[model samples]
Target chain A: AQSVAQPEDQVNVAEGNPLTVKCTYSVSGNPYLFWYVQYPNRGLQFLLKYITGDNLVKGSYGFEAEFNKSQTSFHLKKPSALVSDSALYFCAAEPRTGANNLFFGTGTRLTVIP
Target chain B: SAVISQKPSRDICQRGTSLTIQCQVDSQVTMMFWYRQQPGQSLTLIATANQGSEATYESGFVIDKFPISRPNLTFSTLTVSNMSPEDSSIYLCSGAGGPSYEQYFGPGTRLTVT
Candidate 1:
C-alpha cells in the first residue's frame, strides 16, 4: 500500500530558529507529494506540493519542502520559525498515474517556544 | 487554486442520528473527496465523488453507511448514517483540480456523537 511516514510525532524549536519536519513516502511510481498544516480547532491549509518540477518546492506561509527522490523524502522546512507557525503538519502522497487519492501521514505536532 | 467551504463547522448529535455535511467549491473541480480524521490521527479517505457518477468508496467504507452525493461540479454532500460514538470525528472535504495536482480542503465539520 502507498503511504507516507513522519518519524517524529512532535518537534520543538525555539522561535527565530530554523525548523524541519521530516517526511518520507513509499509508493509504486513517481508520486505527487504535498504538505498541509492544521491549526487547533481549524481546518487544514495547503502548504506546498512537489509534482514534477524542481526538487525544492516553495509554498504558502513561507514554507518550503525539499523533494529527494533517492531517499524518498519530502521534508518541510523554514528558514526561521515563529510562534504562529506552530501547528500540526501532515505529509501526503498520491500516485501520479492513477486516481487523485491522497494518502496522509500520522502528522507531526510542531511547537515553537517563544 | 479553488476555494472550498463547508457548512456546520461543528455539531453535536445524539447516537443513532445522522448529519449531512455540505462542501462547496468556489470554482468547478474535477474530483472531490471525503475524509475522516479521528482524534489525534491521520486522515483516512472515505470515498471519491465525481460529477455524474456514483461515488467510489474505499475499503472498510460502504455506500449504505456513508452515502455521498455529487450533484454537480461545485458541490457535494456526505451523510453519516446511524452515527455512533465511534463516528465522532472531523469530516473533511477536499477538491482536486486546477493546473496543480494538489488538493484544497475546507474548514471541516466536527461531529461529536454522544
Candidate 2:
C-alpha cells in the first residue's frame, strides 16, 4: 500500500515569510511523489514531482519541495509567501510497482495573510 | 503533458437520479483514473479505467454504484448512480501518459445531490 499523510489541516503565514506544508508517506517500494494545488472551484494544477533524481524539486508559482528518503517526507516549501498563493495543497504518492493510482493525503489549506 | 477536460463542470441533481461525467483527453492515454474529493478533504481514487476492459474499482467503491466506461484511448465516462447527499463531491478524472506515471487532471465535475 502507498499512502501519504499531511499532518496540518491548515497553515497560516505572513506575506513575505517562508512557508512549509509537511507531508509524509509510506509505500511498498520506491515512491513517486507529487504536489498539486487547487484553487476555489477549479481543478488541480500540478506543482512538482519527485521520482528518482534530486531530492529538491522546484515547481510553479515559486513553490518547491524537498524529498527526504530517510524521513519518508516530501514537504512543500516557498521562499516567500504571497496572498495569491493561498489555496488547497495535496500530496500524493504512487508505489513504483503494482498499481499506478495515486494515494493522496487529507490536504492542507494554506492561508497567506497580508 | 496531456490536456484533459470534463463536461458539466458543476451540477445539482435530485436524490436517486444519476449523472454521468465525461472526460476527454487531447491525446491518447493508456490509463484513466477517477477520483472523488469531499468538501474540505483530500482525494480518493474511485476507479481505474482502461480501454477495452472493465474498470478496476478501489475498496469501498462498487461498480454498480459508480459505473465507468473507457470506450477509447482518449475518452472515458463515470456515472454516479442512485445519487444521495453522501455522494455530493467533486469528481476528477486524470490521465497518465506513456512511460511517465505523472498524471494530469481535468477541471473536475462538482456534483451536488439534494
Candidate 3:
C-alpha cells in the first residue's frame, strides 16, 4: 500500500515571506510524488511532480518542492508568498510501476496573510 | 499535458436524484480518473475510468453508487446515483498520458444534494 501524510492541517505565512507545506510518503519503492492546489469552489491545479532525477523540482506559479529521499519527504516551498497563494494544498504519490492512480494526503490549508 | 474540461460546473439536486458529470480531454490520454472532495477536506480517488472497460473503483467506493463510462480515449463520465446530503461534494475528472506522466484535472463539478 502507498500513502502520503501531511502533518499540518493549516499553515500561515505573511506575504513576501517564505512558505513551506510539509509532506511525507510511505511507499514500497521509489514513488512519483505530486503537488496540487485548490482554491475555493474550484478544482485542483497541478503544481509540480518528482519522478526520477533532480532532487529539486520547479513548478508553476513560482513554486518549487524539494524531494528529500532520506527524509521520505517532498515539501512545497515558495521564496515569497503572495495573498493569491492562499489555498488548499495536497500531496500525492503513486508507485512508479503499477496502478498509476495517486494516493492523496489529507491536505493542508495555506493562508498567505497580506 | 492534456487540457480537461467538465460540464455542469455546479448543481443542486434533491435526495434520491442522480447527476451525471461529463469530462472531456483536449487530446488522447491513457488514463482517466474520478475524485471527490467534501467541504474543507482532501481529495479521495473514486475510481479509475478505463477506456472501453469497467472502471476500477477504490476501496470504499462501489460501482453502483458511482457508475463511470469511458467510451473512448478522450472523454469520460461519472454518474452519482441516489444522492443524499452526504453525497454533496466537488467531483473532479483527471487524465494522464501524453508526454508527461502527471495528471491534469478539470475545473470540477460541485454537486449539492438537498
Top candidate when judged by TM-score against the true structure: 1
Question: Sorted on TM-score, highest at the top, how do the candidates line up?
Answer: 1, 2, 3
TM-score of each: 0.96, 0.95, 0.94
Give a tens-digit lDDT track for model 1, residues A1-114: 788999999999999999999999998787889899999987788899898879999999889999999999999999999999999999998887659999899999999999
At residue B51, give the lDDT of candidate 2: 89
Which segments of model 2 are wrong by more than 4 Å?
B98-100
Worst 10 residues of 3 chain A by lDDT: A94-103
Q: Residue A63's C-alpha lDDT in candidate 2?
A: 94
Fnat per model, in the order shown: 0.70, 0.62, 0.66
Candidates 1 and 2 compared: the better one by TM-score is 1
lDDT by residue for model 3 over B25-79, one digit each (tens)? 9999998999998878778999999989999999999999999999999999999
Quote fnat for model 2: 0.62
Model 3: CA > 4 A from native: B98-100
Score candidate 1 by TM-score against the native: 0.96
